[model samples]
Target: MPEGLTDDGLAAMLVRGLRPTRVTLVEHDPRWADRFGARAAELRRVLGERARLVEHVGSTSVPGLAAKPIVDIVVGIDDPDDEQAYLPDLEAIGYDLRVRESQHRCLRAGDPDEPVNLHCYPPEHAETRKYLVFRDRLRSSPEDRERYESVKRDLAQREWRDVNFYAEAKGPVIREILARGGWTD
Candidate 1:
């Protein structure tokens, strides 16, 4: 059984049948910009000042990258574990706590009705903000963006029981780009 999957039997059962969607590289879409802007506004309205450093990060944030069509938003705060400070407000906004991996000092919320991934992290953690930096880097650098797109395309084609493993597979290239961008994580 691969790491991170709760059901080893399920993983074994699905491996033979799983296949990834084909990759598509598109020009920057204006609609993505509009969707992000609207969602950010809503997030700020609900979380108020606690919505610190809300950013549109992930493949969708980067122009011309093939993605799973989910909008990834990063919510940075003073403390991620302190539920009293932000969790209630976020829950009010309709985000469900789908996963909590304190080992990573992070938690993931999901909106099953809507395709969105809300990642909560502490502001003090630089690695947490690296996602934003990476998005920016790819948006501005065509070379880096192309490389990342290629890596993503290849990785997506592989059979993986756990989504986390697919994410981890991109670590090396991501770290290399971060190093080039003078970011240490």
Candidate 2:
């Protein structure tokens, strides 16, 4: 339904599966760290050396920040575009490839009840560095973390057709915080 996506393309995407719509923000949970560690271990076990680097990114990784319950993780591989090399192993471990882009692949684990976002990017990708730096910046800076949490709380009050839309809406603030932290695109 979004602009630039034709009816056929929209239908195909819908057929693939609709993303969960609930966008509730909850207080930071210490268990999120454990969840990330568990998922990281599984990814490492499955991909072995192919998983060049695995890290916990996004708001969930930041302590004391309100965020959607889903755990966000970034997995760096040799080549993200080469699905043949890692897709099967990831799929075997319950990750369903959802968004396949030129530079990255966004995979999902678990059903609508409990979900995880596994972002796969090639090593040295700017997005990978951005995710790491943004996460670290948020974790280390209380002022930025509070600002992000305020933005998220305000956004959570509105209605969203898809949960991802809410995430996209936070981009400007995220970029501002990243800039304050000296993160360049």
Candidate 3:
């Protein structure tokens, strides 16, 4: 578990009994941007003004970086804990609420065929800041981008019970890159 996350919090993040697909990295696809745009539009349509900010994030958002082909999006809302305000609407639109933590709520859209990880957080959450800073840093710094891609490629070959585990394993490298990029939180 990452620092500052309590045992319960870490446990809450785990998708118990849900096995994830083996890690696979593919060359960056330009279609990812289009997909993110479409999804963001859908989210905006569904949430209306409640969707404060919808951003393309994660490796897919960084051009030329190999990723797992999942479109990772960050959706900022007024309050993450207020599920009643948005969860039902999101669920009606085919998003499955998955991980629920203090900082954010995770929802999965699509299925085995096509996957999208939608992360919901308060606009000022530290995790949200990290996502934006790390993504922007990689987008602007080729050296950091290549270093991250190298780590990801190496990690993709390792065994993982859940794909989330693969993401967790990359924590150290992510923190290293974020730190080098001058991200404090």
Candidate 4:
């Protein structure tokens, strides 16, 4: 993890267990989509192919749904621990390394003054692909999107000490849907 706290921890703490306001189920907004593209463009200009498959994923990536308004971007590379190879470049491009999840082989970046969550994951990791699959599935299927949105709403209204615990609470439903969608792997 980063010398201080990993980005995941920071995010959890930042929210102070604030559950997302609501789940959204809509088409992506061209404006936000363009912002993601611009951000990816900046990353590309700086890191070249180091950020192999930079993608906009998360609630903001989905259209028409009310969200927390934070853009979640995934930047994939061969290995995240090999920071020496990409850190300096990313730093130069205006992304500050906020959290490091060494155990998870992931890192998060963002602008200190501005605000965005950029999750870094190794392309070889299952978590990386799983996130993509889940996001894609939610975006394409209204039934699944509504299902997830409903879950978010139900959970958000409840109080929880740890935000992670709240997120973990959704595991069963996520697994159930993923499994039903033929994503048993």
* For model 2, the run of ten residues with the poorest summed lDDT: 1-10
RMSD, each candidate, Å?
5.4, 3.0, 2.3, 5.5
- Order the numbered candidates by lDDT, best leading: 3, 2, 1, 4
- lDDT tens string, model 3, 54-162? 9999999999999998899999988988899999999998998778766588988987756899999988788888999999999999999999999999988887766
Best by lDDT: 3
lDDT of 3 at 39: 93
The TM-score that candidate 4 achieves is 0.74
Kindly indicate the candidate among 1 and 4 with the higher lDDT: 1
lDDT of 3 at 174: 92
Q: Could you tell me every candidate's TM-score relative to the true structure?
A: 0.78, 0.88, 0.90, 0.74
Q: Point to the candidate with the largest TM-score.
A: 3
Tell me the tens digit of each residue's lDDT in model 1 across 38-148: 778888888888867778888888878777666778877767767787777777766666445441232334453336777777755565668867888888888888888
The residue-level lDDT of candidate 2 at 159 comes to 79
| lDDT (Cα atoms) of all candidates against the true structure | 0.67, 0.82, 0.86, 0.65
Cα lDDT, model 2, residue 181: 78
Clashing residue pair totals per candidate (backbone < 3 A): 0, 0, 0, 6
Q: Which stretches of candidate 1 lie over 4 Å from their true place?
A: 1-29, 103-114
